[model samples]
Target chain A: MALDQSFVGRTYPPTDSYEVGREKIREFAEAIGDTNPAYTDAEAAKALGYSDVIAPPTFVFAITFKAAGQVIEDPQLGLDYSRVVHGDQKFAYTRPVRSGDRLSVTSTIEAIKSMAGNDIIDIRGEVHDEAGEHVVTAFTKLVARADREA
Target chain B: MTAKIAYDEVEVGTELPAQTFPVSRATLVRYAGASGDFNPIHWNEKFAKEVGLPDVIAHGMFTMAEAIRVVTDWTGDPGAVAEYGVRFTKPVVVPNDETGALIEVSAKVAAKLDDDDRTVRVDLTAMSAGQKVLGMSRAVVRLA
Candidate 1:
């Protein structure tokens, strides 16, 4: 089934703020096997001009993706979660995300198309700090494979 | 904290040191836990197989993170990256064996942007099991 084309340009309300934690940043860095000091040590981040330990560039993906759930789970969207696969991802940052920052995301459906019987959707997540300042914009593309028998 | 390569010292076509990352089942599990992406295709072999995958695979975001290390390591600052993007061209399949999978990442300065003299665009290639796993991968970083 094709998704609702009207959903394009629909923006969800900002999600509740998620506090970026130092330990979570450390855990993410360690999980990725990146031992960059600026990711784990406050002093190192300070030396680099950040107020505290900073997150790796992709750390915000978790939060923003979760926010995108609002769109994916929309009853009107008609998306089949089982057939979906991530297609592409991109991020543009105003600055590195540091620990102690409270952030929220507003997700909008950028585009929706059907190609080769596959449903492709583009979602854009705009992240902002507690001060309502733009932090980063994450673009995620998801593809739902068409059923073989269809 | 500061970039090791000054903005003035690098130009187009400057190649970054290549690095390889090893991915095991445990690594995928840990990444799933940390990133809050508990997709069955990334950890549960049975589920992955049932879902038409040959084996458990690394998360695309995990691969993206590993690929950007070349830029971060070169700049000596994790915050140096201003923009990053990648297309998931292939899956890095991690077999449930001891050897696991190895992802090799190599990058180069693709271009110097005109709007920002302090920033340059980097092109990256990531390969796993002799197959390219990411396409059109690139990053924009601020240098010292």
Candidate 2:
């Protein structure tokens, strides 16, 4: 079934703030085999002018995607969770996310389209710091494959 | 953060050093835990196969992270990246084995997108198992 077009442009309330942690950043970097000092050492990050350890660019995806769950799990949205796959992703940053920053994300449905019997949705997540300053905006595209029975 | 690579020193077509990252099932499990994306297709071979995948696969975000290292390693500052994007073109299949999969990433300066900010656009290619896994992968970096 095609998603309701009315959901387009709908925005969800901001999620509870998630504090960016130094250790989590280190863990994520290590998982990806990235040994960048800036991810693990505050001093190294400071050398780059960041007040503390900064997360890798894609670190905020974990936060934003979780926030998008509000839309994905919306009872009326009618998206089949088991059939969806990440199709595309993009992020534009105002600044690198730093350790100790309390961040929240506001997710909005940017667009919805049905093509070749597949449902495609574009979601935009706006991330902000505790100070309510814009930090970064993430655009995610998810595709729900056509039901096999269809 | 200022990039170690001076913008003035680089031109369109300047190649960033290429890198190859290995992704075992353990790597996917670690990434899943760290990223909070416990999608079973990334770790459970049976579930992945049932879901129509050949085998357990790496998370698309994991591949995206690995692909960006070429740019960050060149800049010497992860913060220098202003924008990044990628399209998941294919699944990175990881069979249960000591050596699972390898993602090869190579990038080049695609264009000088800005003058005052000293920013340039980088085009990246991510390949696995002789197939392109990411399409239209690119980054906009602010360089010193």
Candidate 3:
């Protein structure tokens, strides 16, 4: 099925509040093979003026994708999950992500198009602190294969 | 974060130290679990081959994360980063071997900004097999 062009410019509800815990941050760092003190040591991050340990950059993916699910799983969008390829991702941060900071994401379907029988969809996720401060904006691109190839 | 280098100490062409990120199958598996991006292409060689890929590939986010580590490590703080962006130019092919694959990352200071916060733009590059995998890479890092 062709992608539903009508889904362009759609916005998803803000995600449920995700409390950024120090341990989750540590697990992410360890999984990525990063042993940075700031990610694991609260004192290290405190020295940097943070109240608690901070998450590594790109740690927001888990949260942001959870938010983006509202858009991708939209039944009306006609996105073929089986044929999609992660094309790219870019992050613009107003501040670094830190543990203990509750965060939420609001996703928007920034763009959609068809090229060479492929459906290209771009999603922009705006992450904000619990206090309603903008923290980061993440852009994701996905390319869906042609139905004929399926 | 005691940054000895200030915006005035930088320019449009100062160079940051180069970095290299090794992509091992184990690391990829760990990342898949951490990031919740359990795509088969990042782990299953058979599915990768079906898509005409060389082998199980590295997650694009993993590559981006390694590159960001350089800037954050240099700044001595993660919050110092104001903005970071990258365009995935190519796939990081991971061969199933004991040693796995490697991607070298290098960057230079591209610009400086200091109206409200002291910051510098760190331009980065990731290459594998002598070919650019991620390009137009850059980050703006804040300073004390």
Best by DockQ: 2
Candidate 2's C-alpha runs over 4 A off are none
Whole-model lDDT per candidate: 0.94, 0.95, 0.83
Looking at model 3, residue A49 earns an lDDT score of 78
Give interface RMSD, per candidate.
1.1, 0.6, 1.6
Candidate 3 chain B: 10-residue stretch with minimal lDDT: B1-10
TM agreement with the true structure for every prediction = 0.98, 0.99, 0.93
Each model's total of backbone clashes: 0, 0, 0
Model 2: docking quality category: high
Model 2 chain B lDDT-worst window of ten: B45-54
Q: What does candidate 2's lDDT look like per residue over A1-150, in tens digits?
A: 889999999999999999998899999999999999999999999999999999999999999999999999999998998888999999999999999999999999999999988999999999999999999999999999999797
lDDT of 1 by residue, A13-55 (tens): 9999999999999999999999999999888889989899999
CAPRI accuracy category, model 1: high
| Order by DockQ, highest first | 2, 1, 3
How large is the interface RMSD of candidate 3? 1.6
Weakest 10 consecutive residues of candidate 3 chain A by summed lDDT: A1-10
Model 2, residue B89: distance off in Å is: 0.3
**Residue lDDT tens for model 2, B46-90:** 998998889998999999999999999999999899999999999
